[model samples]
Target: MFGEDSPEFSLRIFGDIGMHGDSKSDHSKANFSFGSLDFVISGSMGERLTFFSESLIEGEHADAIFFDQERAWVAWNEGDSFYLQLGMDNSVISRWNRLYNHGRWLETTITRPFLATFEDQGGVLPMHFQGLEIGGLLAPAAGDLEWVAIIANGRGADIEDRQRVHDDNTSKSFSTSLTFTPSSMEALTFGAAALTDIIPADLNSAVRNGSISEQIYDAYFTWLGEQLEWIGEYAWVIHHDGVSGSNFSHRLIYLQMAMPLDDWTPYTRFDLKVMDQNDPYFVPVDQDLDQWQQLLGVRHELTASSAIKLEIGFGHGQDRDAGGAVSSDDFISAALQISWTF
Candidate 1:
């Protein structure tokens, strides 16, 4: 730990690395690649305050790496159940979002679900929201509940990557989520979340001028028992582009289960996402994205903070209006990755 003269402040550094290989088709040769490198800093301020930040050196254009911010937040705790935070936040809208990230060592898989991607990664929804969040817990004998409310600049995609910057819209977005954990089944939890925002198609324009109104709905579940853990999530989105006077809808959902055996854990997952074939958002990207994916994998715990994994997955995509040489065929891939934190 690194600290100043005061004992109230301290910091720790950790790193994450990943590598993989893939083949788009059975007859095609596999392509290998370096996944990512991330450095994370987390520390404390006295007893009520703390901060965390992730600085990433991620792969970009072939053999290139660019620096990016995954999360940087300072928080103050009013008590165990109440806290406030301001900064670039991740997974603010969904439970699954909060649970997974670039840290492959922190999760069971190297690849994420289609809906988990950000706007730049071809995701229609916003995963990063620069904003303020107030969250707390409610205690009851029968069950305990957790809730989080968010107010942020929302998300903007027309420009580069500035979703974590200031707002370009006249109005801000509001989101909230609630989770319930029952006493009878302490290992199980269920949650729901919603967000309403207006994303500018032309970020250079004003909010009401040429923006799209978007509303997202989500439901999620988590269960961890003595020998098994399971997760399931579903999200639906509605986009109304008043500028074009057109509406489009999209859906994403997934279910996964993992069980530990001695020092090894095996897992399975299924994911599916669908979008309107004629979505206005597709005009810029050049293709509508829709797919179904399935995965099976196993992880061996080399130590408390390190692991190696082997996974195999398959999927197919359809883009009726696809241009160029885009194929709407099925693909299969396998990967071997190792990750650690220190």
Candidate 2:
């Protein structure tokens, strides 16, 4: 138990060396980088009230570093049956976003699946928001059910705009998810979620002057056994452009599996994204793409608090130009990372 005056704190750091080769380019680039520095604080104010916060420092390059408050929330719990949280939190759209978060050491691979990537990193979905969350767990005759719902300031005019502190519009986003762990097969859990939001118009753009209506539907499952762990998730995104009076749909999916052997673990993952190229909301941000990637990695535990991971990935995608010309992007990459928690 932690006191309010003396909250528990933890720090995690990750660093890596990587080499990437583009099929179109004859030269391969290699660099060493600092991945992230994460700080976490938590404490209990009373028996039912608690507070938690997480901050991250990350580098875009050797000369540039940025700090972000990823999550900060105060919660009131009524045992395991119900809880209410208010503040900034990750959007509960998928299982991966809810499970791993920013804890690099907790994940088996060095990179997150495209489905769970951050918004600033070219992700299509809103990853974080300032919100109110209500959640609870229930035990039924056949299974244990868990549920979560959120209302928040959603996305802004741009894809990278998270609207963390202030909302651009009066319309709030809403999301809900549910998971069930059957009594007979406790190792498996499956869930589904739905989210809706209104994205403000990019007033600076003459072409995209109207708001966008966004809806996302997601489904995911996880199976954990003594030797093998497998996870899969799929999301369908629909957008309606107010100005053009057009509707577009996109799809994103990922599958990951890992095998643990003593101090070593091997993992593999596949990710796919298919988008409608004419979607104004995505076209302006250069996020409309048909892309896929395959990854293989191995992780070795050096100590209880540290691990080393080696990964290789192959990717292919299509790119569209302003004149509606299409191009292909193919790349192969390798990375080695060392991560530790303190």
Candidate 3:
């Protein structure tokens, strides 16, 4: 019989599909997807560290040889108050960003919160900072608090000047967060984080005239109980590049709740996002954007690690739509997901 200690190596296989109606174009395309393999290793070197990385091989970019992430890192435990980690690793800022694996079976929306996306705005922002981090518990109480700070190459993955104001430049991003688990008798915990990068003058080419660099300001919170959880975040961006109106502003607000009964859980969430197109530059061109989204979802847990889910949503453009005044795809989505771990 298989048990938790059957093997150290584990493999995970999963995929998600979304569609509307029964049309060829509408049914076959997926809004989000991923597949990967994993392994765990132990060595003669006392308390050797472990590592894991996932490459997106199917669903979104199915055929390309994409190295989406490479987190080959190691860590050493010094004690309860101190430890060290070296390699490419995700930042310690937001719970949603770090806890929500792509294969997770339950969520409030068909997509992630606007801030959770890894891009420039959401799809490719910095996910892993390649460097070293030293951190540990800062205080001991019924409700505990932990602290972390890292030194890394201030940019994200595969990003040239897009990740930071410089390309191949060496610098660091300083970040810290506080997490608390109150002494009260309730299943709840919360966290707050702040991050900033000091970029070099010569590498900052994004600015027009003066040698001002890039900056990021973020705050996040989460509360989870037996059956319900709440997540929220806010972020601000400041660019010191003096060309073409060297300023940028963006914000996000999301709220969601879920309840589970037996094997099924139903949920709903609302998202509001606003970005200034006039500052620094324009993406869609000539117009800023305000996006509003409403989502309703349900999930059926087949087991502790596997489940099936269905979701639907609608998006409204507050300003001009990039394609035209009318929305090109004001869509309704449905997805069936199956996930398991071994």
Candidate 4:
């Protein structure tokens, strides 16, 4: 504990050593990497207002480090029923993304689900936003209902670009999510979310001569029992090409389960993504293909603030070449990671 004028600060460090082999290369490589140095600063203003920020320094080596501001927000709350937040934050379209955030030490596995991966990490969805978030809770006779709505700048031409300071177009993006938990089964929860946005075509050739209309819908459920934990989610993405009058639908799904035994927890997960090859929005980004991965992992707690994880993954996918020819690829990977916080 600190004085009233002092702010709380914490740091988290993650590192991993891993090896991977793929059919295309027919070889394996092993390396030790620095995952990230996460810094968190948080404080409060009076009783109803509070603020917090998270930043990360990440790279494979010291010579090529990168800095990222993951979240910065000021929030106002009224008991447990309502709250308003403003600043940079994670998008709530995916439950896993909102739950785990940037703290790798809080997760049970070494890698995230495909749907929860960040855009810069070869993911297809927008995971962060800069703007406002409004949320609240309602208590019913049998259960509780939670809801959130967000307004922010739409994504830029490239998937990795977040448009943190400005917007490319006049239209803003909007999204909403709802979840319900029943009193009869306190460990079970379910939710759904949707988002709509328009991506301008000014500097992007992928959309031809017009803007792209994008919509996403997701449904998910989680069951956390005394002995077992299970989570599942499915998402559908629709992209409409204004120039060609074409619409493409993409699908993503994953299911994960974990069991805790003493100080060790073992987990398994399956992830799948299917895309339309002809969707221009995905072609330029090299995401217009089908992929699936299976993972098995176990976590061992070394101390209250530290843990070690071992994971092995098997993946298969189809890729399209410059000449519009498609080929299949397969890969296997394994990693050992030690994560800690202080």
Q: Which pairs of residues clash in candidate 2, taking residues 3 or more apart in a chain or in different chains?
A: none
Give the per-residue lDDT digits (tens) of candidate 4, residues 247-282: 999999999999988889999999999988777666
Off by over 4 Å in 1: 1-19, 25-29, 203-209, 319-327
Model 3 misplacement above 4 A = 1-45, 48-58, 61-67, 106-110, 120-124, 156-167, 198-212, 278-288, 318-331
Candidate 3 TM-score, true structure as reference = 0.75
* Worst window of 10 by summed lDDT in candidate 4: 13-22
- Report the number of the highest-lDDT candidate: 2
- How do all the candidates rank in terms of lDDT, highest first? 2, 4, 1, 3
lDDT string for model 3 (137-179, tens) is: 7555576666777767675322333342233445567776666
Give the number of the best model, judged by TM-score.
Answer: 2
Superpose all Cα atoms of candidate 3 onto the true structure and report the RMSD in Å to 1 decimal. Answer: 5.8
TM-scores, in order shown?
Answer: 0.89, 0.93, 0.75, 0.91
Clashes of each: 0, 0, 12, 0
The alpha-carbon lDDT assigned to residue 118 of candidate 4 equals 86
Q: In candidate 2, what are the lDDT values of residues 48-152, reduced to their tens digit?
A: 778888888887634578899999999999999999999998888878988878888888888888788888887888888799999999999999999999999
